[model samples]
Target: MPDQSPSSRRFRADSCFVTGGALLALLVVGGLFWAKYNMSTVKEWRGGNAWNLTYEAAAVSGDPRAAAVRYRHNPDSFRKDFRDERLGAIRLPWHTEANVNTGAVARMEVAPAGEGQVSCRILLDGVRVVAEGRSPAPGEPAVCEVTTSSTPEKWPTKPS
Candidate 1:
């Protein structure tokens, strides 16, 4: 080319550096936004996985009431109690958060169903019927396995 001054060459190099830097920064910012937008989808996936694992464990254990209690205390405990290595790999940020509580128990009524059994009706969270079974009259107790249809939508959006 014609005579190009040293200052002009340096300016060109600087402009190239600045443009590359801006592009890189823009990509990083875009990635962060993408991750934020998909966070709910990720949580939804995790919740579904957890619920399925819990349901399997409860079904096998044949104790819905105990399962419900355990879920209340620690939702992630099922993965551990059942030795689910797959689920253990995915850690949830809100593992200790309670999804259901005593206040969620809308109603619980027990009455005699027969000589040795009592009818039980337990409602939870004004929506789910946690338990309904004919339990033993006194000594022996019936098992009521309660599960939630709760998805990530039910989970707290903000950190607790």
Candidate 2:
């Protein structure tokens, strides 16, 4: 075998350095992707586990008998529209809206099950009904039983 010169050895060393650098970059990028996914796991779980509904505002028509409920997802733009430090402004995954008539009893029932479950219920009479839906697992939409007999004359058309 012939003796190798110094230049040949230097060339081999440079090739190893470049290859190592490329491998290091790949590892860093992969790690970042993994971390990002882990951090967003909560969001993904909530997205699939909350109840959502859209109903007419009771104040609009002042008719308690005219109410509807269903499952729906929270609006993506709601957080930006309102700011409340107490709620952590996290913009929950589900919510409800309804129109209530005068002299009506609006009641909400919520039972949540799972890790880190979030439960919320709200009632509004003769005006508006808004509620939050959050839980640890996917389930049925929270129920709000409204009770009112015969419409009242000159119903107050304001929600406070």
* Model 1 residue-pair collision total: 4
Q: What is the C-alpha lDDT of each candidate?
A: 0.37, 0.38
Q: Taking the candidates one at a time, how many backbone clashes does each contain?
A: 4, 7
Best model number under TM-score: 1
Off by over 4 Å in 1: 42-48, 51-160
| Per-residue lDDT of model 2, residues 8-109, tens digit only | 888888999999999999999998998766644544344322222232212111122212233222234222121111111122333445333323333443
For all predicted structures, in order, the TM-scores are 0.36, 0.28
Candidate 1 Cα deviation (angstroms), residue 26: 0.7
TM-score of 1: 0.36
Query: What digit string (tens of lDDT, one per residue) describes model 1 on residues 50-157?
Result: 332111111112222221212232234224222211122111111222333211211222222122333333333334444555444442333434544344334223
What's model 1's lDDT at 16?
A: 100
